[model samples]
Target: MSLILSRLKCPWCETPVTKAELKEKNLLQVYLKRQAFPCPHCNQSITLPERAEKMISSGLFVSVFLAPVFAYGGWLSINPALLFSLGVALVLTGVYFQKLQKVTASHE
Candidate 1:
């Protein structure tokens, strides 16, 4: 499987942000809102793309769909491990999409 690397960067300073930091801060909200937040590196306001809102919605749908299947399969085989793995996969995919979201400069 090919890994999708995040291209999320600060618009003002062009500093790259890691997936961990994105998830930790729930930066997806910023992206969805096309809102500005101060960058840790430069203290300048950074804006993310509004397009990510759609991606986040889609990812949630996929996760919701897979969740039941994985849970049912695990229960049938007496192996609950698959359910946990599926949950992790869903979370990772969501994060990857968040990272993949294109950053657009908001016209203020």
Candidate 2:
């Protein structure tokens, strides 16, 4: 598992991009607008290719499909308001991780 995750690294510094380090807000801009920002590790520009886009879209699909599951899970915890919001957060996190894995300047 670590080896597979180690593949997701910064092209410049080779530092692993952790799930906690990813920015969820900019993911949509990067995927939809073909926009890019600086790398969290090396501060270099990171671009996503077609493969990355496909991966992100698929991740999003899975997230959406499983949203009800997350909502229900949250409902089990008795946080009624968390039902939909928790699901949305899960999808955004999925997208962020997909971008982290797929966005690499070397891959571009």
Top candidate (TM-score): 1
lDDT of 2 by residue, 14-105 (tens): 67655445445344344345456566667676644345445445544445655556556763454434544555565455444543433455
Q: State every prediction's TM-score relative to the real structure.
A: 0.36, 0.34
lDDT of 2 at 9: 62
For model 2, the superposed segments whose C-alpha errors exceed 4 Å read 1-7, 24-34, 52-108
lDDT digits (tens) for residues 7-75 of candidate 1: 666656677865466557676456345566555556566665434445545555545765566566654
C-alpha lDDT score of every prediction, in listed order: 0.53, 0.49
Question: In angstroms, how far off is 47's CA in candidate 2?
Answer: 1.7
The ten-residue window of minimal lDDT in model 1 covers 99-108
